[model samples]
Target: MLKKLFGLTASFAALVGLPAGAWAQTAKDADPAIWVVKDADTTIYLFGTVHVLKPGLSWFDEGVKAAFDKSDEVVLEMIEPDAATMQGVIIKAGLSMTGPGLSEKLPKESLPALAVAAKDLGMPESALERFEPWLAAMMSAMAPLSKYC
Candidate 1:
């Protein structure tokens, strides 16, 4: 029947969508570690690095240093994401501390989990109460991601 064909098509679309969504969550070429792999004549070194280096100490791997010193140009994720850009994204991403902010945007169910995690770390919830829920969620997510970023 026509109904059966429509159901099959919808199911197929749902199956195809998951990978695309996962890919969207990850950085395509942004990982710093991938540059370490081999290939071209112009060697691109992505130095694996510690998340937090001790004061006055650094791990500049030879290959990475060579690439940096040899290269005529350097680029970062952005020239700078200055105040205006930050404010704009805060507005757009709903990171504002006031109004509905990130609080209303998030599923109500996740709040208890967030509170528990913050408390477990001894990170006071009261201090963070004014922060937008989106920002809080990001801080929670990004804590583990510091190494990757």
Candidate 2:
């Protein structure tokens, strides 16, 4: 059963133009297209949705709402972990205790800027001390998304 399910999943992933291991990323600028295959008694459709959209867009028209309403079932492409699960994963990943302090890792000249940014973000400078550079960068990039998400 597991093998059959995995094979079915791989086939569907390929149908959607995603290679294996690329499911977590998206091509943001691709032209949108829908593919359909139909036979005597069956039909399969493949479509894409934008990964992230800002609020208050005027593009979702009545036709779009009707298409969604007419569908018998819907499948979402991703699963977001709840806060507790996210906390557990963060703990497992050691995001709170990686290595040398971020301030110490930065050049002496950059510490003041880092501290200022941290203060602006309402984070104490010491709070981010243990995060590696890449993690710190990702967190900073998440500030905009954090508001609506």
Candidate 3:
């Protein structure tokens, strides 16, 4: 089960267009483009909502709402993750991988940024060592989470 779970995690990482190692480190804020919309014709447009974040983040952006109001049926990005599904993904993936820890991943050289970001996120070094990579990995999968925050 653990092996399969790990493989599933890897598969999900790839499916989301991120590397497995992306789970192990803190990333800077980046524009969310996991979801996109483009015009198919003068009378039609397509909205692709990747089910990777909280809808509260960018789901109702002026442009997206305007596009929705302009259109008829809504085509979502693979059915969006409801609270339950999102919770399953979060639970299965976030706390699974930890033995390697953040200390090894962050290195003594990068301690300063780690310290600051850790404080901001309320993570202590030892506790974070157990959690950092897993949470980071999960975030990399859910690009929308960062967008929401």
Candidate 4:
């Protein structure tokens, strides 16, 4: 299945005039990765996506475009929520319901580092107290990447 997908991708790349070394290039110059899964009853091609591209970046061509054009059904990871609705959902689901605050749950030594990171991200350290640990960590992880979007 993998070899067949690669053969099709390579053939399509040639058809579209991409250089043979296209696959060997760095990510900045190459297409995103994709995977194919097949059984007797169904075939699924999974696209690895960044969801948003930097302005002026162009990737929706060649093998990616060909796969999309040939797909029988398209499934997306999400339907984007409106800001207000999204905020409400996060408040409802992403907060600690009845546990020790985030700071209290952490080792005493880690609190200072967490506070520093939160402040550097322009988030009040106290605000993290209301979050579930996973949500807080996710927010911290995603903060730096927000500028890209």
Best by lDDT: 4
- Candidate 1 Cα RMSD (Å): 17.6
My TM-score estimates for the predictions, one after another, are: 0.42, 0.44, 0.42, 0.66
Which segments of model 2 are wrong by more than 4 Å?
Answer: 1-52, 58-78, 94-98, 107-113
Per-residue lDDT for 63 in model 2? 45
Question: In order, what is each prediction's RMSD in angstroms?
Answer: 17.6, 14.2, 11.5, 14.6
Error of 1 at 97 (Å): 4.5
lDDT of 2: 0.50
- Give the lDDT of residue 94 in candidate 3: 67
Is candidate 3 or 4 superior in TM-score? 4
Clashes of each: 1, 0, 1, 0
TM-score of 3: 0.42
Higher lDDT: candidate 2 or 3? 2
Residues 12-84 of candidate 3 have per-residue lDDT tens digits of 4434542222331344332333344456664555544343443323344456557668876765444435544
Q: Judged by TM-score, which candidate is best?
A: 4
Residue by residue across 18-109, what tens digits does model 1's lDDT show?
A: 22113233223322342643576655555453333222332443545577797766654333244445444544553344665333555889
What lDDT tens digits, residue by residue, belong to model 2 across residues 1-149? 33432332233222333222233233233333445567997655455565333333233344444555656666667564554454445435534455578877778997787777666445767766765555555455544443432
Extract clashing residue pairs from model 4: none
**Winner on TM-score (1 vs 2):** 2
